[model samples]
Target: MIAIIDYGAGNLFSVKNALTYLGLPYQITNDLEEIRRADSYILPGVGAFPFAMKMLRQTNLIEEIKKQVVEKPLLGICLGMQMLFEESYEFERCSGLSLIPGKVDRWDAGGLKIPHMGWNQLSVKQPENPLLKGLQEGDSVYFVHSYMAYPKPEHLAAFCEYGVQVPALVSKGNVYGAQFHPEKSGEVGLQILRNFGGLTK
Candidate 1:
């Protein structure tokens, strides 16, 4: 079973529906015990980074998530993905899972819009990455975020160009993150999730 983490974030219904459509068994819960027992864990979020981190801490799932990332395959979506990094400069100062050495910050550059909304093509960095298995270099993925992650080059698995080369996907060992909302990225997204589901070992 895949555990879809619930911490009062948004757009979880689409995620749940997509997983069900794929005929994959899953449970949405904030219970640490249930999360730990699941074969795989998916962290999905849509909101501000600082607030989300606070919710995780209040629910006492921060350290539990750390443990799971170390022990099993943990997939993070959107804001959840951003939280896998070392720190974020969203609202205030906030620390993340630290699974990857990086920082999440707003796109303060000139010309480009702050929130990069809509579909964008991905440029696969590590072709051998299981998360990007059958996907090609220009596969389009859905994205809706004002901030993005900046992990070290070694940790970057895939990227998408939007004014600058944004880190679209990243992974370090068993911990994985997707800056785009794969649940809403149509066939390509579902394939990514399906691949992750198949990684239950």
Candidate 2:
């Protein structure tokens, strides 16, 4: 079963709805033992980096998450993806889950609006990653964020241009992420989640 970790900070309903629509059975909980034994896991969140980190630490799922990702498939979305990185330069220079080798940085804006919302096309880089299984370059997806991950180029599965190239899709071993909300990005988004759901270690 897939575990949609409820760390008290996740935007659970939509992700749950997405999973249900795809006929994927999942559990939303922070129980350590359940997390340890789940076949797959989804870390979904919609919030600030520092606060999200605080919530994850308070729930004490940090270590369990670390352990789970090493052995099973783990997918992080939006803020959850940001959390998988080493650190984020958002709000404060806070540390992340350290699962991926990268740092989150604020978008340069460059005369464009902040929190680059609305639809944007993904400039796919590492299209061979399983999380991007059925996707093609230039496919549009929704985005709503002010900061983006700046991981190593190889870790970046795809990018989207705003004022700059934003890390839209990322994967490192068993861990994957969608900077955009896969649950809300229409069919394209759902397809991304479906791709993640089918990934196996």
Candidate 3:
């Protein structure tokens, strides 16, 4: 089962509903004991970086997550994905989980809109990455964010064009991150979730 961490800043129910629709066993939890017992984790968020981090720190799950991720797979969605990086400039320069080597910053969309909303086609960078599984080049996913992570190229599994190459999916060892909301991305999204579910023991 996957522990959908409740840090009081996540899109918890939406993620839960998606998991339920896919019949994937999950529990929304803030309890560290519950988190430690779960097979894997899903950190879903939809808010500012500083506030979310503060809330997560309040829950006292940061160290637990840092320790657990070394062995089990963990997927961060949207804002959750940003927090997987070393730091973020969403509002101010704030430290992240530092699981991946990169930093989140406002997108320089080359005169395009700030929040690169709507559907965007993913361009596979590392086709062999297990997290991508059945996904292919041009597979479209929904996105809604003003900032994006510039991860190390080796960790970038897939990206999308939005006047710039935006990191769409990323993975390194047991850690993974999705810059888009798989729960809101339709059938392609469900396929992504299925792929993630297949990873948990």
Candidate 4:
């Protein structure tokens, strides 16, 4: 079973809905004990980094998450993905979980739009990455974010170009992150979620 963390950073109904469509058993809760006992966890977010980290701290799940990711599979989606890094320059430069060595920052824009919305093709950086299993170089995924992760190239699983090399997918050991909302994307999204949901502890 999987546990979808509830940190009040975003509504996770869509994530839950996707998991249900996959027939995966999951529970949404803020209880640290439940989190500790879950087979795997999913941290889905759609808000600011500092505020989301604050909420996780308030719920007393920061240490739990830090400890949990080391032993089990943990996937962070969108803003949640940003929190898995060392820190974020989102607004005031708040520290992240440090699960991966990197920082989050806004796109350079380069005359393009701020939030690189809509569908974008993923350019596989680590083709052998298990998380990207059946996905290919040209598979399109949906994204809606103004900031992106700058993890070490070794940690980048895939990236997409949007005036800048946006971190599309990343992983380090058992921890993984998707910059786009897999629940909102189409079949490719479902495949991504299914791949995560099938992870063994």
Candidate whose lDDT is highest: 3
lDDT of each: 0.89, 0.88, 0.92, 0.90
Model 3, poorest ten-residue lDDT window?
Answer: 128-137
**lDDT score at residue 160, model 1, on the 0-100 scale:** 87
Please give the TM-score that candidate 4 achieves against the real structure: 0.97
Q: How accurate is candidate 1 locally (lDDT)?
A: 0.89
Top model number, TM-score = 3
Candidate 2 vs 4: which has more TM-score: 4
- Over 1-201, each residue of candidate 3 has an lDDT whose tens digit, in order, gives 999999999999988999999999999999989999999999999889999999999998999999999999999999999999999998799999999999999877899987889999999999888777887679899999999999999999999998889999998899999999999998889888988999899
Which runs in model 3 stand beyond 4 Å of their true positions? none
lDDT of 4: 0.90
Provide the RMSD of all predictions against the true structure, rounded to 1 decimal.
1.1, 1.1, 0.8, 1.0
Question: What digit string (tens of lDDT, one per residue) describes model 2 on residues 64-107?
Answer: 78887887989899999999999998888999999999899886
* Greater-lDDT candidate between 2 and 4: 4
Pairs that collide in candidate 3 are none
lDDT at 137 for candidate 2? 81
Provide the lDDT at 175 for model 2: 89
* Model 2 residue-pair collision total: 0
Query: What is the C-alpha lDDT profile of model 4 across 97-174, one tens digit per residue?
Result: 999999998768689998889999999999887778888788999999989899998999999989978899999999
Give lDDT tens digits, candidate 1, residues 1-201: 988888887467988998998998999989989987888888888889888888878878878877877768888999999989999999887998788899999775468776899999999889999999888889999999999899999989999888889999999999999999999999999999988988877
Lowest summed lDDT across 10 adjacent residues in model 2 is found at 192-201
Error of 1 at 45 (Å): 0.9
